[model samples]
Target: MSSSFERYQKRRLISSYFSVVLSVFLVLFLLGLLGLFVINSKKLSDDFKEQIPMSVYFKDQANDSILKAFGEQLQKSAFVKTDTFVSKETAASKHKDIIGEDFMQFLGFNPLQNSYDIHLKADYVEGDSIKKIERKFKENRMISDIVYDKHLVDLVNNNIKKITFYILIITGFLALIAVLLINSSMRLSIYSNRFIIKTMQMVGATKSFIRKPFIMRSIKLGVIGAVLAIVAIIGVLVYIDSQLPNLGVLDDKLMIGSVLLGVLALGVLISWFSTFFATQKFLNLRTDDLY
Candidate 1:
């Protein structure tokens, strides 16, 4: 009968410990997932910005060799990602296809000018950087005018900034909630051992002595939970990569490593602080409060 009761008590202790670990793992996992999204959002924004093209039309008198050499020079520029040279003939043909008839034939001559559609690097796609690039390009005598949708540029920049700000706010809020939840879990787990804590104090065990074991145990649980969360995050990334091979965001090893390290540190730090405070509460409690 005595051994059966001991076994039952041991089972109950294990169950409580498992519950605390599970709570930490789930919270950290959710936080890590959001971190992934936040990191990738910047990459997606840059990709969209890089797609905005600047069209450069040359003067009608500009010869083919002069334009070809100029296009090669533009391709070598630091700001240029790619430059697509469109001859008068190609533009007219494409315009004809779009309008469902040969407008050039009706007009008796091709009105289209030779041009290059240049996609700038994301860093140079901003308003000031684009202005600088335009000034530099217009200095070339062969170039007549540089054109791009100024409204679209402004819209993309403004919208991305707003989106990033909101996501940051949401992430910070969720992080605070995660901390509160983990702290509560730790406190409840300690609460179950209130009587044992009191008894240790009554036996003349120093506060530090009593706390050392509990702190170590909690830290061990925290490490286990963090490791479990990291593993789960990796599995999720693998599944996402398999389904969407084009999502190159997972290739950012440094960002992923930073997030994982943060989770591990948070788990350990929160656990230690939560356990220390919870144990301190019971240690200072009067015997009457133990009831």
Candidate 2:
């Protein structure tokens, strides 16, 4: 009967340990996913910013020299990422392709204006910055008019900012909830092992001596859980990259490495803190309250 009781107690402790580890894994998985979102959100925003076009139309009478000088000046500007000078003939051919050969016959000469197709720096995509850029172009004598889709630029900037902020808030809240839930679950697990802790205490063990084993176990579980979460995250990223090679977001090795490190650190920190606090609570509990 004594042997059977000891076996049963060992089984219970094993079960509690497994339960705590499983809970930690689930929480770490969620935290890893959140970290991925935070990293990729910035990448996606930059991709969209690159797509916003700001075109500067040139006067019909403007000479090639003036256009060339203007192009060089624009290239040197802080806002411009890249600029291509589209000649009147090239613009006309593109326009003709759109409207067809029959539409071109009605024109006496090529009516399409020469222009510079400009891609601005990511930071200049906002409405105020773009307006300032447009004003600078208007000051140029060779510029006919600056043409850009204002509404589209505004919509893209606004949407990206709003979505990023929303995701950040939601992810933060979910992470907090995950930490709290994991902490509670770990506390319950440690509480079930209260007898073992009590036995150590009765043997004149110091508080630190009794807590050492549980803390070590927690750290081990945390490291294992972090590794598993990183593997899962990598699998997801690989699948995504295969499907969308143009994502460009996942191509950054440094960013991805940082995110993985962050997830690992978060897992270890949360587990250590949770277990430490839980064990401290159990140590303080009255003998009668151990149940």
Candidate 3:
């Protein structure tokens, strides 16, 4: 009968420990997923910016020297990520490739003018910035027109702002849920040890002495749970990176390291506070309540 009681007590202790670990793992994994989304969004923004080119078309019968100089000037601009000078022949070749016919041959004269294809940096991809850049090119006599997809720029920027805002709200709400879940789990674990806590108090044990062992045990469990959560996150990231090769955000080591550190700190901090508060409640309870 004595051995059976001991086995039952051991099983109960294991069950309480599993409960704490499971709560922490679920919270940390969700947080890790949020971190990945934040990192990947930045990369996606840059990719979209590259797709809109700032095109500068040269005037009809413009001097070759002036066009060449303009191409050099474009390369010197801080906002220019890349620039390509499109001569009449090169433009004709591009059109032929697109339409599968030589329009210049049908028209007897190539109507296409020389142009410069300027790819701007991510920071200068907005409508206002692109407008300012266009005005700058208009001052040059050799340029005929500057063209780009203004609607596309506005659409991408506005949608990105909305997405970022919604993600922040969702993450904050989830964080509060995580805290409440972990705290409830910790309180239940402490409730099981109420008899031990009251017996310690009866023996003249100080509150600090009673709390020390529980705090230490909580920290250990928190670290273990964090490690397990990180392992699971890594597995999911690997599968995602394989399926989506274009998501270079997954390759960012520094950001991912910081995220992992945050997870570890959050897990440990929450566990420590939960254990401390739960122990305090048990200490303050009446002896009759322990029954």
lDDT of 1 by residue, 27-133 (tens): 89998898998898888888899999899999999998999889789867999998999999999989988989988677899888999999999888898999999
Q: Over the stretch 59-141, how does candidate 3's per-residue lDDT look in tens digits?
A: 88688889888878877899899999899889999999999999988699988989988899988998888889888989997
TM-score per candidate, chains pooled: 0.92, 0.93, 0.95
Q: List the residue pairs that clash in candidate 2.
A: none
Task: Assess candidate 2 and give its TM-score to the true structure.
Answer: 0.93
- Which has the better lDDT: candidate 1, or candidate 2? 1
Worst 10 residues of 1 by lDDT: 177-186
Q: Comparing candidate 2 with candidate 3, which one achieves the higher TM-score? A: 3
Q: Write down the RMSD of all candidates, one decimal each.
A: 2.0, 1.8, 1.5
Model 3: lDDT of residue 208: 97
216 Cα displacement, candidate 3 (Å)? 1.3
How high is the lDDT of residue 132 in model 1?
Answer: 94
Candidate 3, residue 142: Cα displacement in angstroms equals 1.3
lDDT of each: 0.90, 0.82, 0.88
Model 2: residues with Cα > 4 Å off, grouped in runs: 1-11
What's the lDDT of the predicted structure labeled candidate 3? 0.88
Model 2 per-residue lDDT tens digits across residues 1-291: 999999998998778777666776777777777777777777778767878777788887899898888988987798888888888888877877887774457766777788999998888888898898888888888788888889988888888879888988988887888789778767877877888888888789999988888888887777777788889888888888899888865778897888889878877888889989999888888888887
